[model samples]
Target: MPQHLLLIEDDARLASMVAEYLEQSGFSVNHCGDGLSGLAHLTQPPAGAAPELVVLDLMLPDIDGLEVCRRIRALPAPLSTVPVLMLTAKGDAMDRIIGLEIGADDYLPKPFEPRELLARIRAILRRKVDNPAPNGKTLRFGTLEIDRDARTVTVAGAACDLTSYQFDLLVALAERAGRVLTRDQIMEAVRGRELDAFDRSIDVHMGRIRAAIEADPKDPKRILTVRGVGYVFARQQD
Candidate 1:
């Protein structure tokens, strides 16, 4: 079956164009003009059907796009876990950073090409469906435990709250514990793309992940930053 997508964009023209393009590309697209209605669609999806992804615009009629993204993240699981791709007209770095920090799976600046949008959507979906790690594999390091199949992480027996992207980032680091990976390496491994110059989305995401899994995010022990390099997952958690 074609994938289902919810597009929360206030621009009527843009929404119609995007919906048509995505539909031609073999997706079922539902468009909502405002944030509140969009949130409702996400929260109370059709009785038996829910969108596989959300393409959210940063500008909205009711609530700001950022707030909408937060509300989506706050939803109960499987809903909260749905991937979000943020669309913004803003070229500011902070906007993209904030979007990713708030659990958006990907970000696209406005006036983007339809093809690129399609590619990004495909990439995010790929990450959702493809599990690189062997099934049933679990990585244990002292108080931290990562279950590959379950896609869950726990520190000291307490479950950590992580977005889908954050969970993937953590798994990528833990799978190669003790080996330092550059930002390029980490992004490519988890996102299937190289880091964009001046884009600190990865760093923002790392900070969020640390906050979720580390006993003290300010001084993380599991994911250590290497000066002038990238980051590493400690082999020994003690």
Candidate 2:
């Protein structure tokens, strides 16, 4: 069965092109002209027809995309955890960073190739299927626990809220704990394409991941920054 995708884009021409292109690429797309309608569709889909991913436009007719993303993350689980790939026309790096900080799995600047979009969508969905921990093993550091099979993270028995990409990033780092990894190595491990341009996005994701799993995001111990080198996941944690 084709994976379902919801495209919340106000541009009719672009939406038509994207939906048609994605359909041709073996994805079933449901396009909405505005953010509110998109949110409504996500909140109440027809039976089990919920979308597996959302292609969200930064600028929307109503509520804007950032607010819409915030609302989606505020929704109940499964719904909140849906992968989001943001489309931005601003061509601004800050917009992309802000989007990642607020739970978007990935972002593509406007005037992008349809193939890249397809690849990004595939990458996001692929991460969901690829388990880093072999045999569904759980990686525990101090009181923090990551269940590879469940795709969940908990600290001190409390659930940690992380986007799909952020969860994968954490796993990539934790699996190689005590080993300093450069940004390229981390992105490579996550299988996220086009890293040279979007390397800062990794820092944005790591910040969010630390905010989720680290007791003190300001002074993170588990995930440490090597200052100009990259980052390292401390093997020994309190």
Candidate 3:
């Protein structure tokens, strides 16, 4: 079975090219030219099946891609967790950061190679399938609990809503608590790739994770910043 992908891009020429290429690359591609229609396809699946991944364009006819991403994240479970890879013509760091902060799993600047896009898609999907933790193992730090087999995190017995990527990042950090891991190392461990120097996507993800699991995101303790170094998972979480 080929993985299904929904592409929400307004440029017909580019959409057609990408769809054809991805189809040849062993994916089933569904193309939507506008944000609303794409949202509909995802929220109200045709044939009772939603695409496994969404390749979203930042510029859409009906709505901006950021709004579309927000709306998707607001959808009910399973649907809300669907991985999003944002595509943008803008090379601005702010745009990429904003997209990731809004729950996009990854971002690719436009005029990108199809192979790179395919690789990114595979990387995100692979993270979803691969669980590195030993079965039944759970890591506990004070009130926070990370269950490997269940693929869940709970703070004070209440579940935290983290995306698969964020969950993986947390697990990676927790596995090596009390040690600072550079952004490059952390990215390699969780994303299976080196961090791009200009890409602050990791920081954006960290912010989201803090918001979900921290008592106060403003003063995070569980995942501490090493300041000019990287991040450390506190050995002592109170």
Give the per-residue lDDT digits (tens) of candidate 1, residues 1-238. 8889999999999999999999999999999999999989988877644799999999898898899989988887778888899998758678888888888988999889999999999988888777877755898999899987788888888988787788888989998899999989988887655676877788898999999988899999989999889999999885
State the local distance difference test value for candidate 2.
Answer: 0.91
TM match of model 2 to true structure:
0.97
lDDT over C-alpha atoms for residue 127 of model 3 = 88
Best-to-worst order by TM-score is: 2, 1, 3
Cα lDDT tens digits for candidate 3, 1-238: 8888999999999999999999999999999999999999998777735798999999887899999999998887778888899998767778888888989988889889999999999998988877776554899999999987677899999988787788889999999999999998898887755776677789999999999999999999999999899999999988
Candidate 2 Cα outliers beyond 4 Å, as residue runs: none
lDDT (Cα) of model 1 = 0.88
lDDT by candidate, in order shown? 0.88, 0.91, 0.89
Q: Kindly indicate the candidate among 1 and 2 with the higher lDDT.
A: 2
lDDT tens digits, residues 166-210, model 2?
A: 989999999999999999899889889757764588889999999
Judge candidate 2 at residue 61 and give its lDDT.
Answer: 76
- Which of the predicted structures, 1 or 2, would earn the higher TM-score when compared with the native? 2
In Å, residue 29's CA in model 3 sits off its true spot by 1.1
Badly placed stretches (over 4 Å) of model 3 are: 135-137
